[model samples]
Target: MKKLLAFIFLISSFAQAQYTINGTMAPILESDWVILYKIEGASQKYVQDSKIKINTIDVQGKKQKIGTFSFTLPKDTEAGSYRVTYKLENAGYVDFIFNKENLNFGFHPDYPEQTVTFSISKENILYRKYLEKISNAQQQLDSIQITALQNPSLDLKSAYQTSLNKVNSIQNEYLTNSKDMYVAPFIKANSRNNPSEILDNPQTYMSNIIDTFFYDVDFTNKTLLNSSFLIDKITDYIFYINYSDDPNTQQILFKNSVDKVIYKFKNIPYKKSIIEFLIDQFETTMNLELIDYLFENHYYKLPKTIQDQKYITSKRALFATGIGRVAPDFSWIENGKNFKLSTLNDSEKYVLVFWSTTCSHCLNEVPKLHSFLKENKAVEVIAFALEDDEFGWKNYKTNLPNWHHVLGLKKWQNKIARTYNINATPTYFILDKDKKIIAKPESLEDVKTFINKQ
Candidate 1:
């Protein structure tokens, strides 16, 4: 009986505490049978929270869906930990966002009128350290946002979530440390510096940053020698972005500014009690909303990656073709006109080697490369040649006997070599069917072995 009661209690504890979000209908959204988007991390595709029938639903009250949505303490959300994403595939035939549905331009808000703000002492080592952490954290978070911002989708949401978790953890730590009035400035500092690195200590670092950042584009002004100027500078980025012309530039600027602001307010002096106010008002309201925007940007950049996917394939094809990625694409261009990058990829199994005719290491690997090609018939060997003159290439090609071969964009200065950071003689990268890099700089045998297994 006791176990049963405990289990029941546990289940009840997991039940979501419900609340309603009231958004005034924009009239247009009211009539169309609307579907709510829990947009997928990394793109535009969204998952319909199948449980809910309508996006603008009436549980106890009427509400309208906003232009974009991110998961939060939704009114009906359950209490247990969830990895829910905002996505856009309603089984199949549905699109989450469309002017096809007819929505207006993305909303941009004006800056709120400035008024009272707090400052923390820079002299306190603990306070300085606490502030430094916040600043550092803000930078890490912002970088991730900027990286993700080239596109906005479910994957981006996941990445944003990772950053947000760190921020939340830091804020929670700050809340735990808030007994010290000294660190209270940090709580306010982070919230105040949203979308930018916190450059100032609450009491210092402000004046120079303002005099320099606001007016001069060079950003060559003196840094906060003292804590006071730092605090003020941190505040500037938060307040500034609402006024910037380009939204993309705005994201980077704000991140840089906020990192500086957190520098002065957090670290050792960080406290939990002081953090509650900031988390409630600052992090939750401003910074997080800004993160959502950046994630949308991240989603947009993925297609660029997708579009470029076709161009880069062979070790040489990828680097020479100008399809440079963290790891170049999986590719090949052999069998004369019949062979192309896409065709090689269709088989999903291949070893790509980028080498030069003049490369001694490449010369040594030739017979071994042929042996691998012979042994692993299922796996194709794509050998890219970096031959300055066609004569050396032809000679090297004739000598290479059987593995695939092709001349690169500029021989030694080939695009593939530069892109893959291959200043050396020979470079190798193995790829999976999904076009992800499995290994690089490995031996020809290692690459062949991998392809055979695949």
Candidate 2:
């Protein structure tokens, strides 16, 4: 464990952040002071306070005075998406200092007057905005509902629907016309009344857009889809997306790619639905055994939530994907061109190192790895950096010795991380001549030991 900690530490430039919290609301006679610092792309921390804030409420809920504290983001702080997160000792809620705009794109709320507009370049970003809009809009409707207690004439849903209608108009105009697949689904989902419809009936609504309907998702269609349509459409979509490959808009089509299908699909029917589908399909369809496909076969899809999602221990047993298990296939661009990885022929084995400059461990391990490769001139080490940071990774590239250096991926949570299950830093997996897993977690000692044994 100490070695593992040391090894992971090699990836760090040892940067840290500091902040000061100050304010007052009430007295804190019993609760302990808790100062927390949260960043976007990196981990958050709790530390001693040198900042200020309204005195937290005590156990007895008495009035208190205000005070302040301070902290800092170290000079070595890595350049990445981040934010300041905090919470008072007595308060139950956590406060976010960084604006939501970072996670979302074009998330404007009523810019100038009575109307608000939203536009997003990516599907994921659009989804966040869509969810946010729905939530906030509902809040407004809920507020109006308060009047219903007295007059019984207030229609809160009608009030909220009005706001959604305007949003729907914007979605209809942009989504259908755009080639972006997210546009269509997003507009379609928003045009419906509630997220429940999206969760319950993905198939029928999706199928109509593809087959029968002309794919119009404007305010014209107010009726939400039923459960039956959703299930059928989703199943068909799962298979359809699996087979079809759109070249013109190649990357964009991955918006709903069924590749990483999850258990959240069960959010609708956790109990009876999983079994019902199997029985119903078996009775109707030909040549099929009744079986729970996800849990029985592809159970990796069942994650309770994003952060604690059990794609690891619960996802069955996935090998480290070191050598065999088939190569972690990838294609990238380099030198103002394309066909980087694809150019490699499958006839021989290859050593691909997905790394980053900020990852200090890569600095130490890679050079030595390259030295070993140099001795075996026949072998190849494609050091494709997961980080595309020009200033960040480029500096490390200069000090490194001669070897193949590949780029393109800028995010740590890129395709490679997902494929390799790269939880820790400075990981080395070796492949045999046939691109089979020969060794993994090939520490410096492991490589030295293996090579000597060979």
Output the number of the TM-score-best candidate.
Answer: 1
Each candidate's TM vs. the true structure?
Answer: 0.33, 0.31
Q: Residue 116, candidate 2: how far off, in angstroms? A: 69
* Model 1, span 1-454: residue lDDT tens: 9999999988776544323221122222222222344222111223233222234444458664433222223335321111122223322112111111111122111111111111221223344455667667767766665555444432555555676677767766765666444334434434422323322232233443343443322122112111223333434446553335776776665555544433333322221111222223343434543443333332223335332232223222423322222344434445555555444554455556777778788888866777656755465666777777768777657766656676685776776566665666567766555444555635767665666566
Model 2, 304-352: lDDT tens digits are 4432234333222244362345556566565565544545653244566
When summed lDDT is taken over every stretch of 10 residues in candidate 1, the lowest stretch is: 108-117
Q: All models: lDDT?
A: 0.44, 0.44
Candidate 1 CA-lDDT value: 0.44
Question: Which stretches in model 1 have alpha-carbon errors above 4 Å?
Answer: 1-122, 125-184, 187-338, 345-348, 416-421, 432-437, 448-454
Q: Candidate 2, residue 149: CA error in Å?
A: 85
